[model samples]
Target: MTSSDLCATLDESDALRLLRGGQFQLEGRLVDASNTTLRARLTLDGVTARCVYKPVRGERPLWDFPDGTLAGREVSAYLVSQATGWGLVPPTVLRDGPLGPGACQLWIDEPDDAEALVGFVPSDQLPPRWFPVAGARDEDGTAYALAHADDPRLAALAVLDAVINNADRKGGHVLRGPDDRVYGVDHGVSFHVEEKLRTVLWGWAGRPLPAEAVEVLRRLAGAVAGPLGAELAEHLTTAEIAELAGRVDRLVEQGRFPLPPQDWPAMPWPPI
Candidate 1:
């Protein structure tokens, strides 16, 4: 099936069940990752799809997050994205794979006309509707700006990062879909109980959220203590779930894009 057709036919629950029960064949290693990740084909009940698999044993431990929890955090990010009704995250689930228990996320294929993956562009050469994230002067004295395509979908992704406390949202993780929608991926470093948000979407800093985004935030604020909260509790610490609720409340109240933190670089290292 085409990517859009699969997306249209499979709902989140259907995708999750497939990830948990489908036969997965390891296709290759995604060698660019900091930790181990595999590309695989998942087939079940006459449906076939591609997924990225990250096993717990392959996870590199971080000082801030507990060991072997990155996969669960990825699943949690999917849940938050779905609960917000934006469906910003591609379908994801936690399951046992060839390597071990891991995260299986739907793979997004990029189109030919997609925005350049190399995010560093000279300030004067940005495409229409793109916005500069930050600028720097190269050692050779050339000026370039880190930028992202400006779209309402990206704006929604920024809000999603805020609520999930995503600590790493680099340019390459933002997939430009064939449908012209943007999907955020690689959310393993997220939902910490602390203020550890890091992203390149700071272009929206301090701007009032659109009414629709704010409304989603408001709905999330109330839902967190209900089913959403229950689902997240299965993967996150109780304190982390509480913090997520607090973040939702604060974002709904502020109704504006958050600025970068003073103590940490706003963007992740290797911005793309």
Candidate 2:
């Protein structure tokens, strides 16, 4: 089946099974990525899908994060997204690939006419209902702004980033899936015990949490205290998991979106 057909047909369980058990045939690599990110086709049980595979052996160590643990953190981010019931993340699993055990995530295909929910817009011509997070200039001195839509889907993702402490939420990492869902990818730098929330989706900064997000957080709190926390322990360190729980509690109590960190860079480098 084609990639679109596979994405339309597979439920969460099927996607997880295919990712965990399918054979990977590397097709190419994302050269721009900081670590090794391979594009490959995965097949199992007569089903085929395109996926991105990041092998643990190919990880580039960062001074802040422990070496070789990026893949597990990617899986942990997915788990948190799932627990929130928002499904902002694509289905991801930590499994052995051609290179070694690492994160295998379903690749989302964008429709030909899909509208971008995040991007650079002319400084004085921001779209309606969009919020500008920062300003910039082209090489010739044309002004632009880094912005995102006032979209609830993107807002939920912003909350997920907060929960995961996502350190790199560049605009390219946010996708508008053909399945009509907003998905976030490239989460290897998330779930740090420190507060490192960075993203272009700061459209709702300091605003009251949407009622829907508050309700989801309530359900998530219970899950984090029970089975969900247990499952996360497989991919995250004990301290990291505890911090995740703490972030959730603080969000629920505060009932507002967080402001950008003053000590850390508020956005990722090359914000796009």
Candidate 3:
């Protein structure tokens, strides 16, 4: 389905109900190095939707994150994104599925030909509009450049990552949908209480947040201290929820994209 069709047909309540109550037919296990993710079709009340299901039982234990908590983090990311008014994440919910209790996220139907504009470019020959994310070196000791699109949506996504403390924002997580809008997915590792904001979307690092994005951040700041805070507490630790609110407050107060923290790894490994 086109992006518009997906947006128009899927209501948030319906998606939540289907994810929570529908019978999920597992299509297959999606190949990934870190976690066991399944592509499935959920049918409810004679209606069906394609979704990605991450069963808690299949989660690979991580050193830093609590065991079996990735699914909750995924839902929290969705809620935070929705609260921010960008809907950066697709509809997702925590539910019992074919494998076990887990996260069921609506799949984005991006066109096959569409791709994220991520890669290494020469420092001196950077493309117009595209901005450098980081500088690197090849085996020959030559300069390697990392970059991403200058689109506003991508910029907004960077802000979303910051607010959620998304630890893994690989290039593959960004999608160009059939309707030509960019959609972000795979938010299993986010909202950590600590400062872990690894991503490849530093194109606007150290720049002022766009006006609309700043406005969204302001709204998010207000929501996080009220209803949004209560909702997120359901899935995350009290400390994590407070930290999430603090992140939003800081961003709205600063009004600019932040530079990477000095001690933490600025970008995720395999920086696609």
TM per prediction: 0.94, 0.98, 0.91
Estimate the lDDT of model 1.
Answer: 0.88
lDDT of each: 0.88, 0.91, 0.84
Residue ranges of candidate 1 with Cα displaced over 4 Å: 2-9, 116-118
Alpha-carbon deviation at 117 in model 2, angstroms: 0.7
- Per-residue accuracy of model 3 over 1-272 as CA lDDT, tens digit each: 43346555777788778778878788998886468899888778887878888989999998899999999999999998889878778889998887889988887787678766777877788888898878998888889788887988898889999999999998878877555767788887898888999999987888998899888888888888889889888889999988988888899888899888799998988887
* Model 1: per-residue Cα lDDT over 98-198, one tens digit each: 98899999888888877663388887898787878899888898899998767788899999999999999998899876666678999999999889989
Q: Compare the candidates by TM-score and give the number of the best one.
A: 2
Error of 1 at 65 (Å): 0.6
What is the C-alpha lDDT profile of model 2 across 205-225, one tens digit per residue? 999999889899889889988
Q: Between candidates 1 and 2, name the one with more favorable TM-score.
A: 2
Give me candidate 1's TM-score against the actual structure.
0.94
Q: Pick the candidate with the highest lDDT.
A: 2
Give one clash count per candidate, in the order shown.
Answer: 0, 0, 0
